[model samples]
Every structure is written in structure tokens, then in C-alpha cells.
Target: MIIDIIGDIHGYADKLIGLLTQLGYQHNGQCFMPPKGHRALFIGDLIDRGPQQIKTLDIVFAMLDADVADAVMGNHEYNALAFATLDPEHAENYLREHNETHTRQHEAFLAEVPFGSERHHYWLKRFCEIPLWLETDSACFVHACWDVDSMAILKPLLTRDNCLTPQALTLTSKKHTPMFDALERVLKGVETPLPKGIVMVDKEGTTRSRVRVRWWLDDLDNRPIREIARAPHSAIAQIPLDTKAEPIDFTLKTDKPIFVGHYWLTGTPTPLSTQVVCTDYSAAVDSGYLTCYQLDTECPLPLSPNNFVQYRHT
Candidate 1:
């Protein structure tokens, strides 16, 4: 089967359209129809830090509803859902993070997402249960980085978890709350803070954002600088290299293809062992283009968000 995996969209629906065209994904109205058995998968971060957030939601939700695509949640989406309880000021600020001119638009989008009936539900429902690791006997897909044996531990979790049903695992085993509940809190004006000692760091080791990105550390994906340098792009910024605690060690359990994202890849699309792959080119920011890859064919095509078309007006 030809599996098409897409990296972070970050509200760039128009840009995604261009990439879809290049990837040969045909369209019907606002929905898309992939070639038979040519399914699509998303690496999440479906909202925030960009314009047209709702449009992004509309397209992905439509595609998934149409059974043309599958998706996994990203940190941003997690934050959005979490902010749903952060009172008015925080909620407004969260909306402002992406320069959302219409808060109601965001409100509507969040309301439409299906978080599902699962207890112990840490992670969003719709895409959250898609499994951190996807594996066919011949392939696998993960969103972030891993080491020599990271895939080994992942296969069982995915298989035992059965990411196929998506809804099959109501309460995600990730030891966290689902995005739906968290977002409800934000909209309700609840205060949610970053993890302890996770103060953002800069080149000179200074704090930057109010929040942090260290979930992988708890997921057993951490390593010391000495150990990390062995991996490709270990020194890449936004990688959260300098942390006190670390995550558990992992191993690749299968000889299948693993498509993943989360880390912003700049130069080349490095494959760990012909089975592991990353698609995130950090599309939502000023850094570079969004990316998508065909699992069966193994092709990466870069895309450009077309907000520039409206830049002159702003």
C-alpha cells in the first residue's frame, strides 16, 4: 500500500494544497480523495502559530472523516486543548499566539474535534490515539527521534495498544489527559503551567518562552550530550539538549518502515535504519517548508505556505 505521511501543517492550508497537488492527491470540493489504498497520515500540530487555523482544521478533519488520512497529535494542539480552561485572559492570549482574528472560529474548531470516550485519556482523542509508533510487518512510523533500540520498545506498545481502531484505546496509555479535557479547562479559564525546572533556554542558556517542550524526556527518549551527539542533528536548536532529568532508553523492535516527525529537520531527510523516517521540516515557522513522504515509495516533497499571497494587504 502507498502510505503518504504529512508533516506539521500549522494552519497553512493553502500551502498544504500545493504539496497535495505535487503529491498527486486529487480533490473533491473541500474534501480530498487519495489514490486507492494510498492513505495519508499527519504528524499533528494541526493548529496555532499561524493564520487560518480553522481552515487547517477543516481540511484535516474532513480528510480523516473521509478515511483518506490518519493523524497523531502534536504539542501545539495539546496546548490549544489545554488552554481551553485557562480563563478569558489566557484563552485570549492563546488565540493571539496564532494571531487569530476570530476567536469564535477557534472556539468552533475546538468544539468539533472528537476527543472520545476513554478514561485515563492522556492525549487528544481524534488523532491522539493514532499511536506514537505505527508498524506494519514491513514498516513503522514515529513522530520524534530515537536511538539504537528506541524502536524495539515501541512496537509492542503500538501493537498492544492497537492504534488501528484509533478509538479502540479510549484512555490513552500515555499517562496524561486528552487534549479535549485540557482544552475545555483552558476555555473555562484554568491555569496550566509548564513542567517544573523546565525554564526555556537560549544559546547562552537563557529562558525564552513561558512554556517548554520536554515530553520526550518523560517518554524515555533522553540522553546526555555525549550520548546524543552520536545521533544526526543532535545539536539542532529546539531539541532541548540541556535538561536535568532524562527519559527511558528505547529500541527499534521491528524491521519495518517507521514514519515520524516533531523534530525540525533542515538539510537532509536522514533515515535511521531504512525502517525509521522523519517528515517534519518545521513547516509552521519562518525556518523552512512543510514536508510529506510516501511510505511505499519513500519520497519527500517540500511545500510552501501561501500566506505570502495576502502579505501585501497586511
Candidate 2:
């Protein structure tokens, strides 16, 4: 089957529809129909960070109901669930604390789908239907890093279809547990500690001592932190190397192709490695493009850049 692995939508409905149309999906007053023998696979983060939140959800659900599309749960979607779920131990608080930072990051989605409204509850139910990861005979689709170790730990806790069970959700919502760590690693990717006394400030001005790493790199253990980091090299190029750093052994060992999103990658879309691809191209930001990696599931490994399709707008 031909699968179109779509990146994070982040409420950019217009860009999403543009990419869909370009991929030959025709809208029939409701859902978009994919070309024969083709289907769309979303890597999640379908809501928040953009203007058309409701429209974007509607489009995706319509296609899902039409059986032309499937999706995995993203970190944002997981956060939404936690935000809505009241803490059993402390009823006044939520599973996701309503602190300033969390609220600010979630305000856009909450603004569109008011908390406790029928629409909000409905979407949350739909979100529950989304699995945490999907695996076919030849490929795997996840929101972020597809760490085999994490998946093994998470397997039984998840539902039969790999979705979060209520118990699993609760376990994952709380920090410090094996479940939480596994969920975080898969949904948010892996991070490595920076050298002592070195830190980098993110766009939001938050100082970070650890950096997200390219987990798919076979030689990640041998690379410099700047080169191994997922962020721009120039951002951390000046930091002194941590010569005593412990080796990081988080590389993917599979020969089967894996597709993931969640990283706000810039520039032209390309296969991250011979067997791995990151579909996210910062679609939620201005000057960013909505992208997808078109794949024939039966095709050989070592994906090519030519298959990267995008909806670009200045």
C-alpha cells in the first residue's frame, strides 16, 4: 500500500488541505478521498500553535471516519488529556499542572475548544482512540523517537491496539515511573545531558542543560555533542566538549524504515538517516512548510529525498 506520512499539522488547516490536494486527495463536501491504494498517516500534534484548531481536527476526523487516514497520539494530545483529567489524589489540581508555562503553551487549543465544553470532551474521546504508535510489517510510525527499549516497557500497559489504557494514562501522567519515562522518551524523543556548566537558551528564553539528540544515528556515541544534538550546530558549537561524557547507546537497530515527527526541523525535508525520516518541518511557524513523506510500503529501504512532498507558502 502507498502511505503518505504527514508531519505535525499544528492547526494549519489551510496548509494541510493544500498538501492533501497536492497529493491527489479530492474533497467530496466532507472528507478528502485518497487516491486508489493510498492512505494518509499522521504523526500527530494535530492541534494547537496555530489558528484553525477546530477546522484541522474536523478535517482529520472526517478522513479518519472515512477510513482514508490513521494517526498516532502526539505529546500535545497527551498533554491535553492530562490537563482535562483531575488528579485523583488532589482533586483541585489536574494531572497536568495548570501553571503559567503549561497554560500558555495550551491556551490556543483551550481557547478554541473551551474547557469542559461538549466539543472539548468529544475531541478528547477521539484522541483516546489514537494509538501511541503504529507498526506494519515493513514500517513503524511514531510521534518522536521509536526507541525499542521504551516500546518494550510500554507494550503491556497500552491497550491491545497500542493505545493508552486508562490505567496506562494515569501511570504515564505521573513522573518518575517506568511508564512515564517510556512515554516521554517515545513522545518527546531522547535527550542527553550537556557538559558541566554549559547550557543553551531556547527560543522562549528557557535555559536548557540537556539537548535533544539524533537517536537514529548509529555513531551517536562517537559524535560531538554539537553534531549529535538535534538543534542548529551554531547554537552549541562553542561549548567545550565533554570528554568524560558517558557513551549514549540509544541508536535504532532496525533495518525497517521508521517515520516520526515532533522535531521542529527546518530547511528542505530529507531522510534523517538511511532508515529513518522526520516529517516535521516546523509547520506551525511562519515561513514553514507542511510536509509528508510518500512511501510505498513494499519499497526497498534507504528512503530518498525526492519522495518528500510539501506545501510551501511565503
Candidate 3:
């Protein structure tokens, strides 16, 4: 029942492979399945801005197909899927512009994705159903924030937003479209009323559907990202304007453990607030490396002196 949570891959398949290999995976000739009782969890962003997008997806999809791994749909994956549905023209142009050997490999990887298949949908239902705030028997996992009142409250919201009926969750349906399309619209909106934040750009490098919201839930008065932060990444990390913000930005409560990977810090972990911790060490930035956290305390690696590190098996 041990969980080996991974961070964003961003198309670095070789690193993922190396890391997985170092973690003691057994290749069944089709995919690398974890040793019995070990489970892998992906934090998403499996593709884009890397040399081996296809290979990355191939590894992920293979592990996923083999039921040895679980993945949460990342904002990037949401963006790509939304791009396919909302703005095919721009998406195609984007593909043409950045599409390379890796893209071709990625294409083949996705070709056999079997997105809405029974088993895939079942996993998708469970994954998409995970809350923005996750609480495990041993730790907590979240892609970005630990906002909602607690994991209990976050579960329903996550489930409602992510999980859907087989038909509703299909990539072809409109119901599911909005699940990811909201990001597109947020990224596309041309009007930046906030004048101080993020202005998102579509995959096609255009701004057609744009809008913004302050941070988590402080004051989502409906503004666009452009006015929130000059840079998209900043906008993403920007704490909404409010004085009543929580003491911590939402993370380790000092009562439990927290593990996350959206900030991209590759080498070292960061303790933003007294309680909040970030594990994303920007492993996908270069060929240098990527990371995995194994939960075996009896034989843990020397990565974290802190006890709350996420788990991968190596």
C-alpha cells in the first residue's frame, strides 16, 4: 500500500526511466510494473517543453495501462485536451510549430491511449475524483493548493469537478469539455481588467478567452490572469490580494505531512511558510535529473532531512 508519488514529467522520459529503474521496477516486456504492494502516482504535466514528449507519455501510459501507476490530470494535460477541443486550429498550429521527433512519438503514444475505455475511465474517475486537498493515512498530496476547509471538503469538490459519468467524462462530450475548457477560457480571455496579474496565452500563442480570479477563494470577483501577474507563472503562484489569508499558503499543518510539485524547483525542496512544503525541484527543466520519493523510512535515501517527504521506491 505504499505510494510513490512523482512530480511533473514535462516530457523527460529518460529521466523518468532512470528514476524508475533506480526505484527497482520489473519490466514485464510491456511496461515497468512496481514490485508487489507498491503503487505509483503521477502528479501530471506528462507532456510539453521537453525533448522526449512521446517517450514520456509512452512510459506513463504504459505504466498506467498496466495498473501499476495512477495519475492526476495536470493543468498541462487539461490544456492540451482542451486545446484539442476548444481551439483545434491553434492547437494544430502549435503542433506544427513545436512538433518534432518527440511529438511524433507522443502522437503514437496517445494513439493507443484508449482514453475512455472501461478501465481507463475507472482510473480516471478515481484520479479526477481526488481532492485539491488529499489526506493519506501517512501523508497528504496536492498539485497546487491545500485551500478548502480540509481534505473532507475538498474531496467532494474534486469529485464533482473531475469525475463524471463515462459519457460525461469522454473527451468528445461538451459536459467534459468545460471541465478542461475553463482553463482555455481563462487562458484565452483578451480583456485583462485587473491590470496587475497574469494574462494567459493559448497553445496557439493567442488570447481569445481570458479572465482572472484572485487567489484560491479569497475574492474571485472575476478578473483575468493578465491583470493579476505580468507573468503566467507568477500569476499561477501569486497569492490573491487579501489580508485575511491563512498563516500558511496551505500545506503541512505541522500536525501532518505534505508533498507537492507544481513550483518546479528540481534540486531542493522549499518551505515557503512555516508549514507549507514544496517538493517540485524543476526536474523537467534539463537533462540533469528528475526525482521520485520512496516511502520506506527503514531504508530511505538521504534526500530529505525532513520527515515529511513524499514516497517513491528507490
Instruction: Write down the RMSD of all candidates, one decimal each.
Output: 10.3, 1.7, 8.9
The TM-score of candidate 2 is 0.95
**Number of clashing residue pairs in every model?**
42, 0, 30
User: Largest TM-score belongs to which candidate?
Assistant: 2
Where model 3 places Cα greater than 4 Å from the true spot, the runs are: 87-135, 149-255, 270-277, 296-314
Worst 10 residues of 3 by lDDT: 183-192
Candidate 2, residues 1-314: lDDT per residue as tens digits? 88999999999999999999999999999899999989999999998899999999999999999989999999999999998998787799899999888888888899999999999999999999999999998799999988889999999988899988777888788888988989989999988887788888776656788778888876777667766787755556645665333487575757789999998999988899888999999999987899999989788476999999999766
- Cα-based lDDT at residue 203, candidate 2: 64
Lowest lDDT sum, 10 consecutive residues, model 2, at 237-246
Residue 217 lDDT, candidate 2, scale 0-100: 75
lDDT of candidate 2 at residue 74, scale 0 to 100: 96
Candidate 3 lDDT tens digits, 100-156: 543443453244444345643443333344223345566555655443333332233
Instruction: List the candidates' TM-scores in order.
Output: 0.56, 0.95, 0.54
Q: Can you tell me which runs of candidate 1 are displaced by over 4 Å?
A: 85-133, 145-248, 297-314
- Per-residue alpha-carbon lDDT of candidate 1 for residues 154-231, written as tens digits (9 for 90 to 100): 334344653423221222222244432332221111112323544345333444333222222223244443233222
Q: lDDT for each of the candidates?
A: 0.49, 0.88, 0.48
